[model samples]
Target: MAALVPFSLLRNYSPFMLARPFIVKGCNLNFSKSVLPLPCRRLPFSARATHDEQAAAKAAAATADSGAPTIFDKIINKEIPSSIVYEDEKVLAFRDINPQAPVHVLVIPKVRDGLTELAKAEARHGEILGQLLYAARIVAEKEGILDGFRVVLNSGPSACQSVYHLHLHVLGGRQMNWPPG
Candidate 1:
């Protein structure tokens, strides 16, 4: 296994590495963008504090809580350059900023259309929903994960859906466990 690096190491490393976000497993290590503060003192990854209260506060502060614009809009508008995997008039597929597996991509719709989360979907959203799922397949194929893949859609805060925008996580390239945590 690759050795786990510390987020603080970026401060001493080159500036270029600090400018971009990278992930190990599903945890986001972007210090600049992280809402959960990293410990300044020496502590192992497992020993670091898990602030459930702080996490809850951050989730409550989610932008556009009532179905308004989210950061995904910026990616779709090309304002924020993403590592796009697949794109079309109706859907967009890009690598997850925080990946869960060797092959992890996020498939989302070009237009949210009130679909802030999968649980918000209505009859009118059926077509676009299908398109998003199909786009996940395209991403899986491009990433060469045809043997197996897991498509995950986190619908609410309880499911750890941090961003309010609807997204389908296409994860593969590893043996996934049942009864997902």
Candidate 2:
């Protein structure tokens, strides 16, 4: 197993910091805090599935959105075992099986209510949406990544909306690049 290097040693940012990178699982990942925050939007931003996330997207696409129950339903119903990070009456959060970041949690509504994807959300779904986003914040806080974290919602296959069920991915613990996919 790879030992964790202290973040304190890499606090001061420098271009040369890239040379002596912080090692995680044998990969040199820069945990710098120099990136700017994305602008706020009235609507949730759609996360595009990139190369690293293609497998998840493909698996999700294979299932499609035929108004069928998903694996999340199993998780919500206690049929699936998950490392739950947080849970409430309206939402449930748990660690991602295939995590993209050191801190990656998926927050979803306990009741799908036709919210197979963000695009399918109706006005009646407003309350659940707010609850989901708030739960994401709570997950970030619990994970000690509130200072810098990301909430991603992939709406469709093109955007890599895996599982059909609406879910918000709370990701942090490292420097996240812009133009996220």
Candidate 3:
């Protein structure tokens, strides 16, 4: 273990003591250092979104609803086209139309059973919820992202849930960032 020197002592030491290369007895020691990037002075956002984008964002956040049918119903009933990834008697897994990642799939229960959102889930929903999560894993396996995948549930408007139906988004195929937006 390297010796621990107080930071105050660093200021008093010669500039040669704090260097990328510190030599001792004709032997050069290479020590790498990480320098944090300086804080940006620019605005937090690059540009303002257009009216349509703002409206869409608002709509995405307006799904704090219940006991309502959404587009997922049509997809479930085969009334609409969806690329089915995995399916069983209880749960259905399909590819997301607007995918956030290369391997993106949506998992949901065949019957809503009043489970419009995760926050509204009750004890009766335990079995189906487990099935949905299992189906998500099956989707990950089929999509070749079983090694690293994410299961996401947007419960309400604050979570950016556009559809009122309860569904899990299985995303993978790249490095996911921390503190997801």
Candidate 4:
């Protein structure tokens, strides 16, 4: 017998589609009636994203690679107050608003120079890219987690890159794990 998809599942797509029958494999499936169970099981934390994370990801997707001035620009210009950890001619390191680890810092270039994201990096951006990585190390050292730390760069919305400006996240202060989400 063919399986019927839940009308509830089709509600999000198109209500009119529920009356249509679709064939898959060797059986015809109708979406008007639900033969499957409702209320799916909760996924484990390691395989699931929290509500807040999901929301952030959606927001990131909306604004990904826009090439617009981001909050980091304000932080760099001193318009927005940030807990500055390190600053120099080219790079600025500060505490992250949403810390992923006990010690979390963001290392960004003072001037974006069209380096909105790592994927947008050009040959000329090699210098600033190196500087950002070096700044991450400095941040890790100053945070007293030089022995163990992780540097992460979420390139696009698919990678959860909320900020458009190219930046590196320096995280430490606790034991880290593999396959970091």
Best by TM-score: 2
For every candidate structure, what is the RMSD over all alpha carbons to the true structure, in angstroms?
10.1, 9.8, 13.2, 14.7
- The per-model lDDT (C-alpha) reads 0.73, 0.77, 0.72, 0.75
TM-score of 4: 0.69
Task: Write the candidate numbers in order of decreasing lDDT.
Answer: 2, 4, 1, 3
lDDT by residue (42-113, candidate 4, tens digit) is: 422333556556668669768765666689999998999999999999999999986766788999999988
Runs in model 1 deviating more than 4 A are 1-64
Number of clashes found in candidate 1? 0
Q: Per-residue CA lDDT of candidate 3, range 1-181, in tens?
A: 3543434323322333344333222234223443222223332222342344445646865654545567889998999999998888888888898776668899989898888889989999999998988888888888899899999998776665667788999999755667666
lDDT per residue as tens, model 2, 114-172: 88888888899999999999999999999999999999998877786768889999999
Q: Candidate 3, TM-score vs. the true structure?
A: 0.67
Please list the residue runs of candidate 2 whose C-alpha ends up more than 4 Å from where it truly belongs after superposition. 1-20, 23-63
Candidate 2 clashing pairs, residues 3+ apart or interchain? none
lDDT of 1 by residue, 38-145 (tens): 336543222222355347536744663665567789999988989999998899999887565778899998888888888888999999999988898889889999
How does model 3 fare in lDDT? Answer: 0.72
